[model samples]
Target: MTRRNRRMARLALPRLAFLVVPAFLAGCASPPVRFYTLGAPAIATGAVPTGIVTPATPVVEVARVTLPDYLDGQDIVVRAGNQIERSATGRWASRLSLGATDLITAQLARGRTDLFVTDQPQSLPATWRLAVNISRLDVTRDGTASLEADWSIIPHDANLPILHSRAAFTQAGAAATDGDTARLTQAVLEQLAERIVAGWPR
Candidate 1:
């Protein structure tokens, strides 16, 4: 009510406003929540075929593998109803084909057979050629991954596939992550390789 009291009240009001405003701003500026991703594990290499015969004259050659061009052009299907992540380079590197190449390399390194050449020249001496048909390769949110392949091994002189077979394998993973697709891809390749080696003609 007095003049001095009124002056003191007015000064105190400004200080209180300053303190309250800072506190309100600090509360509003809380830190943001963070999210993280997890990657899938490597595919397991199954049992190696038994009773494999070392060739008397091991053929040392690599066959040229042909893949459907569409597989490289199309988006990799990671999961149903989920859009595939485009590479920063705007192209997928043909992961399935890469996997097949890796499989051939691995088999060559096994050292069971002596054949070891990279080129596919018609005149080059090769025991057999590898051809593959990719049926299904997909990752799913249901913690399941699958790969299916139909393959054949034909002798150089023969038009018909000397040996033909199909191999399919699936495994359940916790979720998708880096290299999960690669792992599944490897699984399919390994199975195909095993089948081919097991069914090699005597």
Candidate 2:
């Protein structure tokens, strides 16, 4: 209404706009992070075989599954040319080691009827222990994933020998989206599981 009041209102408008700009930029810079899990697509699922149970059947325990320190974290890792980088908007649902162990254990249990496999703490002594150490795990935005690991199956009997081996897997698919990257990873892990089962000693 008054001249002084009109000028003051115009000055206040610029100050309010400046204050709002920073908050808007912050929101745009940070998007909601999505979580993914390894071996979630169920590519290697099998119904557990049922039959007359035998006490002589062996139980294999997953002693441990470990990944490189950088790859063990929750962030989704990607290979960008020669450098490795973490995804900005995606993360692993659980630590890579735990997820990998669970995936392998579940498959091993259902894949064979003559043997049992578990990662849980067992009260009864296990006949065999399996240890896996992952040295390399990476995925590209283009949907190619690679995994390299060394593993061993050790017998509880001191006189028995251990079986040690290394495996590498490469999986390619549509990986431009985060979900696609996750599925690509699942494919890699599924292949790894199949490799492990094939190596299991009869």
Candidate 3:
């Protein structure tokens, strides 16, 4: 090549690299994913109160909750009127289908002192089975959270009548962050648990 052309080529090479390096680095960098759960806030071990379980107390098995196809996954969603948006960085630690059951089991155990509630498989047969199904969960970025669900208290004996009930709950709060949104979800589920425990069958 000519002397003048060679000098221009050398000058352009370094400039091109300097311009491209930052863009390459930026493209490689990605936001970290954050995980959230429906479980209640942690409490100090000694601070948690326990219930007395006698042999006579009936065992209630809490079956996993049935959720809608949209909500059964891990994505944390926000509802804006007719549209739904998924969070870019936030995700459910456990799938909602299972998480909702865990939350209900914990809440049921915490709400009552006379009943033995468990979500795990037990050697002792459960006298009653608690089933929960979710119809909808409406959550907004900064406004409110609401959910609709129906539950049944089924007896081990077919002769006994099974009680069926439905409930709708709403919680008003500021859920600007994903963590805040998870807390709001927990609050509404706790309200649903209240209704279920209140309607406990004889």
Candidate 4:
């Protein structure tokens, strides 16, 4: 081999080694994934303030909720215009489909004790059934949480007519952190629950 070529090869080896070592170290030091949930804590007995009368019980079942394909995973999704990104180090405590359904049902039950909320078909006859389809539910680059859904309230019995409507809602997140993103999403869902209950027949 020529002396010049041999010298060049030796120099290239050190440069290649320098590039790979840090990448290996970085992979080892990467942070672990953090998980979050939107479910509310159990309400203690008598914790509710006075002067609020409980509404009459309404038997309601929340049918399986449908979410956009983008949010079918455990990772939290965020969007800005045409760009969308999933969290690398933060994730949902439960799958989005199940989590969203439970979150909404719980929120409704909390406000109105007379309402019985369930995710599955219950043996107890339900007077009303709620079905929700979410078109958009994501945090934006500006730290805003937005949700758009088409929801319906149908009489469990086929004889009764159906009530359907659309709701588009948004709320600013607590902060730029992942926890805040989750909190903002929960707040948006609470608003959605309110819209659904407001349509209750007199």
Candidate 5:
């Protein structure tokens, strides 16, 4: 109420306001929430043809194939070299390592003859080894999907390869979405499996 008291109150008000304003501003500011997409659905194929004779006595154990450094994760880089933003459903982000491994496993399983295939690494008493290499896997903006795979089967002792093959397959879908991509990939793998199985030695 007094003049001096009023002057002191006026000076203190600004300091209090400064502190309160910062606290309010800090509360208002928050880190943005990051979003990711759910992976696409897996494609299915018909049962593998009968009489393939996939190692009746387990003569060879198929080893897990090594994937290239690129295409190792769901961190996808678009055609323009920019990372694609993941959708709310978690599609179109990228393929996981396990996904690639599974794809190869399934392909081999369908084509396997006189060989046992597995994803786990193990030292097995087997007569042969199978190796796989994935060269390119991509889904273009135009909805065309492409896949290239190289594979070989060799005797455990000899360096010479018993069976060597390379396959490239493509499928065009209505869209470049994850669902379409998975479908196309599955189709290509199925075809490749058939080819490999047809050529496999009995």
Candidate 6:
């Protein structure tokens, strides 16, 4: 309408545009989150056995699974020269401890349907219980996922009196992409499962 009013309107337009443009750009620039599981596709196909057995195997309970302080967070963590960085867009579908427990249960039950494996507290009498503590689990810049853990199994009761064994191990993951770190992590867990089964009383 007036000359002064027109000048004020022009000045306001640039300020409004400056504020709005950045907000719009930030929204567009922000990355979308990509969630991943600990295992499945990355592990070798048919590596897990199939088919149910005639006699059901003993009930096994996953008592507890723990992770290192650095890896206890929700984000996908990578280690570089003793510095750990969390991925802004890459993340785990669930907690690493829970994922590890689930992966361990699946790997053990893959071939042996007879064995009833569970993560919850045993309602019925549990013949065996497993506890695992992971010290270091992270994907590095070198394209390798590594896992270090200690685990043990305890039998409720046995005529043969199975001895409790405590073992610690370090396993390397094989994966082509950084995004496939979960797969490599799963492979490491499979190796841990095999070790536990090997020590089970026959």
Q: Model 3, which residues run further than 4 Å from truth?
A: 1-24, 41-55
Cα RMSD, each candidate: 10.3, 3.7, 4.0, 6.8, 7.2, 4.8
TM-score for predicted model 4 compared with the true structure: 0.75
What would the per-residue lDDT of candidate 6 be over residues 1-202, giving only the tens digit for each residue? 9999999999999999999999999988967788888763232321324444333457778765799876775678777778987777788888878777777776665644456666777667677777788877767766666667777676777654445554444446544444766666666776777777676555
What is the C-alpha lDDT profile of model 1 across 24-120, one tens digit per residue?
Answer: 9999884543221111123222212333434344343444444655443424445556544432212234444654654654454352433432323
What CA RMSD would candidate 3 show? 4.0
| lDDT tens digits, residue span 1-202, model 3 | 9999999999999999999999999989878889998875342211213655677878888888898899889999898878889999899998988777777777777666567787777787788999999898878876699999999999888999999999899999987888888888888988988889788875
From the highest lDDT down, the ranking of the candidates is 3, 2, 4, 6, 5, 1
- What's each prediction's TM-score? 0.54, 0.80, 0.81, 0.75, 0.58, 0.75
Residue 93 in candidate 5, Cα distance off native in Å: 11
Instruction: Put down candidate 4 lDDT per residue, 1-202, tens digits, no spaces.
Output: 8999999999999999999999999989968889988765454322232234344455678887799887867888778688887778889988887777876676656665655666677776677888999998988868888899998888868988898899899998554677777788888877887787676664
Clashes of 3: 0
Clashing pairs in 4: 57-114
Q: TM-score of model 2 relative to the true fold? A: 0.80
What stretches of model 2 exceed 4 Å from their correct place? Answer: 1-29, 40-55
Q: Which lDDT values do the candidates have, in the order given?
A: 0.52, 0.80, 0.83, 0.76, 0.56, 0.68
| Residue 93 local lDDT, model 1 | 44
3 or 5, greater by TM-score: 3
- At residue 188, give the lDDT of candidate 4: 89
